[model samples]
Target: MVDPRRAFALRDAFAQQVTRRLKVPAVEQRAYADRLQAALDGQTLGGLSGEYVVLVDRNANVQALFIYFRATPSDTWQMIGASPVSTGRPGEYDHFITPLGVFEHTPANMDFRSEGTQNDNHIRGYGQRDMRIFDFGWAQGQRGWGKGGISEMRLQMHATDPDWLEPVLGIRHSKGCVRIPASLNTFLDHYGILDAEYAALAESGKSLWVLKSNRQMTPWAGRYIVVVDSQRESRPAWAPAPGGKALAKVPAGASSAD
Candidate 1:
C-alpha cells in the first residue's frame, strides 16, 4: 500500500497543478483526486492491467477528464494529464445519464472519427480535424444515446465543438458521450495506451485495432475507462472560471508510465 501521507501530499500537489493548468478550483481538484483514490481502492479496473487509465468523475460535474499513469500494475496511479469535458445532462435525451462502470476501449469501434469539420449545422461539433473517437461500446443497455434522432446509446469519448460545446463544458450537456478537449482527443489518438500493435497497424496503412484473441498481450494495452459518480451535489466555486476559456494544453508524445 502507498503511504497515506505520501498519497495526501501527491493529491495536494496534483490539485494545485490541475488548478494552475485547467483553472479548476482547488476544491474540485481535491474532490476529483479523492474520487480517483476511491476508485483505485475498489480496483475498478477489474482484472485489466496497464500503465495508464482514463477516469471520469461525474460528481465533478463534467469539470474535467482525468488521465492517470503508473509505472506498473503494482505502482500507484498518478494524475498525468487532464482535459475539460461535458457529460450527459439531466432531462435531456430521455434524461440520458453517462453510465458508470469499467469499460474497455477497443479499436474496432473507433474507425469513425471527427475531423472538426462543420456539419450541416455549420458548427464544429467534434473538435479539430482528424480527432479520433475512442468508443467503448454501448451504455445503459443501448438505450437513448444518439445526438438527434432516436438510436442506440453508443457511449463514446471524443472531442467537441469548441465554439458551442466547449463553452458549455465541465457540465452535463452531452447526450451520452463524454465530450473532451480537441487537443486531448488528438493526443490520445496519436499515442494510444498499450497501443503498439495499433500504432504498427496504422504505420502499414491500416488503421484498426480489432481484438482477435483473448490471449493477445501488450504491455501498454489496458486502455480502460472508469467512470465514477460525484459525491458532492454542487460545483465548487473555486473550480476554473467556467464557460470554457480553453484550458492549458498538455503536449502530445509526453507520457511516463513510471
Candidate 2:
C-alpha cells in the first residue's frame, strides 16, 4: 500500500510547482490536496480494476491536469504525468464554465482523432497532427459551448494550436472544451486513455483516420476524468498573462506545453 502522507505530500509539491506558473494560493492548495486524498481513500472514482485515472484541478486557476496509474484496484495510485491546460471560460448564455464532477469515458462518444489541420483562415485550431479527442459527450450545462446546445454540450478534451494556445495554457480560455499541448495530447493518444482499446485496433488498420473501433474494456482502459475547482474568491497574484516573460522561459518538455 502507498503512504497516504506521502501521496498528500506529493500533491502539495505539485501544487507548489503549479503556483509558480499559475495563480494558486497556499490555502487553496492545501484544500485541493486534502480533497484528492479523500477521494482516493474513498475510491469514489469507479472503473475496471487497475484502470488509469485522470484528475483535473481547475481551482488553481492554472488548469492542472494530473494523470495517475494503478496496477490493481487496491494498489496505490502513482503520479505518472501532468500538464497545464486551458478550460472553459466563465460566462452566461453562450460561454459556459467547465462543469465539476466525475465523468465516465465511453467509446460511443470518443470515436475520432482530429488531425491538426489549417482552416481557410490559416489557423490550426487543433494543434499538431494526430491529436486525440476524448469526448465525454453531452455534459449538461448552458447553451452553446463550441457548437452544441444546452442539453447536449459536446464537451471534449483536445490539443490546441501550440502557436495560438501554448502561451495561454494554465488559464481559462476555451469555449468549453479542455485545450492541451501537442506533446501532452500525443502522449495521451499514444498511450491511450478513454480510447485505449480502440487505439490498439487502429494500429493495424490502413489509416488512423479510417480505423475500426473496438470498444472493448481492458485493464489499462482508463475511462474516468475527475474535475474539481477551488472555491476561493481571489486569483493568485503570481499568475501571469498569456505572453508574459515569466512564462517564456519554460523548457520545451516542462510542465508547460512546448
Candidate 3:
C-alpha cells in the first residue's frame, strides 16, 4: 500500500495555517458524517481516521483518496485545521470527483508567485479569494475562475497536482477545478503554509498516510494505492485492498494478513 506519509509535502503557503468559521451546524455536520459512513460502510473503498474529521471522493481511474484530519474539541474540523489538494472528475467537463479520507495537512502553504499581493498579507492569493470550500461554486461545473486572470480550480480541496492512481486526463481531465471536504477546504484557504512542524507517530512509522478507498472515484493516472478504512478480505482485513504490492521506491511497512 502506498503510504501518503511518504507523499511529498512541498512548502508553498502564504501564511502558516487556515482559518475556520463553522458555517455548518453540528447536527448537519454529524448528518454529513452519517451519510458518508453509510455510503462507505462496506462499500469497496471505505476509510476512517484516528482523527474524526475526514474527506472522501473519487480520485482518477475510479480510485479514491481519503484526506483525514482531527477536529477541535468543539467537534469541528475548523477548530483544528485543513489542507489543499487536487481531486478527480466524473467525466467530460465534470470536474467534481475526488476520494474521501482523513488526512492532516494544515494547508498553510501558499504560492505568492501565483497568489499575488492581496494574499501576501492574508497568506492567500493576489485576489484573496477564500476557497473555504465546497463553498465557492464555479457557476455550475467549469465556471470557477480566479481574479487577476487567476482561474479558480473550483475544487473543494485545492492542490498543486491531481490525486490519482492511474492516468485518465492529462491536460484535459478537469475543466477548471476539483473537489475536497468542504470544511477542510475552507480552513486551508484561510491560512497559508508558513513555517511548519510535523512528527511521526510512535505506533506508526509514517505520520502522513493516505487511506485510499477501493472504490474508484476516477482513474488513478497510473499509481498504486491501499485501503486504509474498510472491512474486507484485504491483508490488513481492517483496511481492504486488491492490487496493492510493495514498490521499490517505498520502504517496507506493515501490511494486513489475508
lDDT leader: 2
Better of 2 and 3 by lDDT: 2
Candidate 3 to truth, TM: 0.27
lDDT of 3 by residue, 118-231 (tens): 221222221123222222222223222232222234333332211121112111133333423233343333322111221222124543222112212211111111122222
Off by over 4 Å in 1: 1-34, 37-50, 60-62, 141-152, 194-221, 244-258
Tell how far residue 252 is off in model 3, in angstroms: 50
Deviation from truth (RMSD, Å), model 1? 9.5
- The CA lDDT of each predicted structure is 0.56, 0.58, 0.27
lDDT for each residue of candidate 1 in 179-209, tens digit (9 for 90 to 100): 7766666545544543544555655787353
- Candidate 3: lDDT of 242? 20
- Model 2 bad stretches (over 4 Å): 1-49, 72-76, 119-121, 143-150, 196-219, 233-241, 245-258
- Candidate 3: stretches off by over 4 Å: 1-20, 43-47, 56-156, 159-258
Taking all chains together, the TM-score of candidate 2 against the true structure is 0.65
Inter-residue clash pairs, candidate 2: 59-230
Residue 234's C-alpha lDDT in candidate 3? Answer: 21
